[model samples]
Target: MKKAKAADGKPFQGVQKLSVSLDFYGEKIDVGTLAWSKDERRAYFEYHPDFAEKRLNVSPFKLPVSEGAKAAPNSPFAGLHGMLNDSLPDGWGRLLLDRYLQKLGYDFRLLTPLDRLAYVGQVGMGALRYVPDNSLSKTDDAAIDLDWFAAQAEAVQGEVDEADVDRLLEIQGGSAGVRPKIMIGLNRKTGKFVADDGTDLPEGFDAWLVKFKSNVDPSEIGKEEYAYSLMAKAAGVDMPATKLIETKKGSYFAVQRFDRTESGSAHVQTVSGLLEADHRAPSIDYDTLLKVTRLLTRDERHVRQMFVRMVFNVLAHNRDDHAKNHAFLMAKDGVWHPTPAYDLTLSEGPGGEHNLAVDGEGKNPTKKHILKVAENASIPRAEAEQVFEQVQRAVDRWAEYAKEAGLSERRLQEIDRLLNKRGPTTAPDVDISPSP
Candidate 1:
């Protein structure tokens, strides 16, 4: 594809001016300039003149939003901040982008951020749609070979071949994560997963993302994530049902895609894209996220969901729960809600505080801090207390879930050490599960 245009009938620019519309459920909510200053130190987005709404500064980055923007920086490429960055596949997607560029006879180094956003098409997280079009298999939903995907991922990663990367992007063009992933639809009858490249399907299947873990990821990483999911559910966080896909090599962590429907289409929105925020840095605070949730959803229920997730991350010691990891989903009807949680793990983020803070407080966030936030957001004291209690219980049972998931002793101990180091004050209501 080519660059998506603004309402003024001009191609979108990167360095000078950024103008793109937010398309949700086929309606344009707002349009703004995704502009970056000459130094690239700051970026901003404002509403287009076509819309009757007031203009607001979204962010300071190139192509910060998903589809409806450009792929390369000067094009509709989604920037590498907040939500859009999370939606764009990192380690694997970057590799594929380079490969795709080489195949198109363009230098990967020369491709702009907007170029990348165009390529993301419909495969990005959340409900935002990009311009030009999304790449899907001719078949709507078909069975795919997970093992083959794994092998190809390894070949690309090991050899760093542009051809393989290009092929991979062509095969699975729209995903957001560090792992090499492909969208597949499983046949209920045949028990096979199908790769749908935006086309007709073999029948009895819809779209799903099959992720391959990198070598740096420990073997038990899948198991631990599964455990985390169970704990998150217990803590009242909305999480998609997760399963362990057992293969001869090992088990792969598989979460049902929140964006996809039974028809195999998707509706994903990251916190980054909704607020035009950045996910890579420490710019946004949890309070800002909470405020935005209320502003966008206008439902206290959604805010509560956000609160539960925050408590679960803090209590579970999953500090890697950055802005991107948390997201809101948009429906075909145009309503946005919090999507089922994924990417939960035992993580100690930058400097032992959350990648996204709790009301501007990071280290040593207390129950009092959480309650104060709840009160400010009009969350009832009883509900807020319930969230704290449930999460505390779930974190206290970590060892049981970890053991069931078969985490190695050393790895479990390492996570336990980090958990303990966070101090008892974080969750005075719960006791640390004994590590074996």
Candidate 2:
């Protein structure tokens, strides 16, 4: 960390270099060193020689294990590499950090990506941890207060100056996504939650993420998402266990943290980080997604799993299928596999189109476009059709899920209309044979 004099002669501390490590169930593997170049206006990373020898391929495509230091590209993820950028928070997390830093008299505009990573320190998602640790808060083992936190989240979102910004940031747990959420340890047996500061939890407690509604979200957003999770699971899409935490104020949605395990943490990298693709826009298509799954995992089952998720996203009316929403988990042996699906909900995306298009068709992608992507990805036509039908059948029973979730008839009927408006779910008679 380096300190420079600000305009008022106050010292502004910035992180110049950070050591990166991967922690798998208490075992640590030193990954590399990241250094910022003031002259070049970018950051460079080099894999530790030992880690390079292991050939773990933490980031297979953009940040593959190499001998020499490499500068990160300028475009997609600001000046930081996608892997490191993944450790930094975006959306709600960024908002919380910005507000907290402003309250501390720090200029948010002057902080570089490296500084942000240092703040993330050891509490970021996945297994990667950065040092020297300059994180703002310690592990807060306080009792869980969902209603209070929800009110505070609303205050933060409304831009109301909050005196408990530190507490808010602490509970925020450096989570990503557009909605305000907190990391907690939930005792499933007792339905009790404890604050999870990214550290070891009490016995019988499991790490979970609880989401609060944003200003734009509907009143029954939690119920709706819970319903989607049910439908997705029924469609054969792998999903983490989800719950709707009913409170005196409102209901909140919670899901088990896939990155954390009973023994240790799992190394998770989003498609955005792996491919260095921007998730804010339509940077890649489902064809690339399936191909990436095939290439990375080298497993046909994972490929089929990706196909099912894509089909579920389309049929379930989930257009927020951005790159960041899809992720893969790497084991201690460095073997990679697709993580369970998350962030499955109704979305209009950017201008009411899917963030990831199907066969170059974003709006109104029919069965033809869907099957075309499957064919290009080498998924058998019969299997693809079966997967599509499975997902469509699950979606067709939306009323059951909505009722189970206790959603209003008005909201349920509205979603039904939007879902059915996507045209017929039956596969056309077009030939899906490979072309010569």
Task: Give the best candidate by lDDT.
Answer: 2
lDDT of 2 by residue, 1-436 (tens): 3544545668877889999998876779899999998877789999998997666888999998879999998778778899888888898889888887777667787788898888888888998999988776664456778998889989998888854677777767668888888999999999998998876789999999999888877778889999999999999999999998988888888999999987798889999999999998889989999999999999999999999999998887788899999999998788999999999988767777888999999988889999999999988899999999999999999989999998898778778766764334453321111100
The global Cα lDDT (0 to 1) of model 1 is 0.61
TM-score for each candidate, following the candidate numbering: 0.73, 0.94
Note the Cα lDDT for every prediction shown. 0.61, 0.85
How well is each residue in 91-183 modelled by candidate 1, as lDDT tens digits?
677777766545455545644454565566554544444554434334433445567677788777776553355446765646655666776
Give me candidate 2's TM-score against the actual structure. 0.94
Clashes of each: 66, 0
Cα lDDT for residue 106, candidate 2: 72
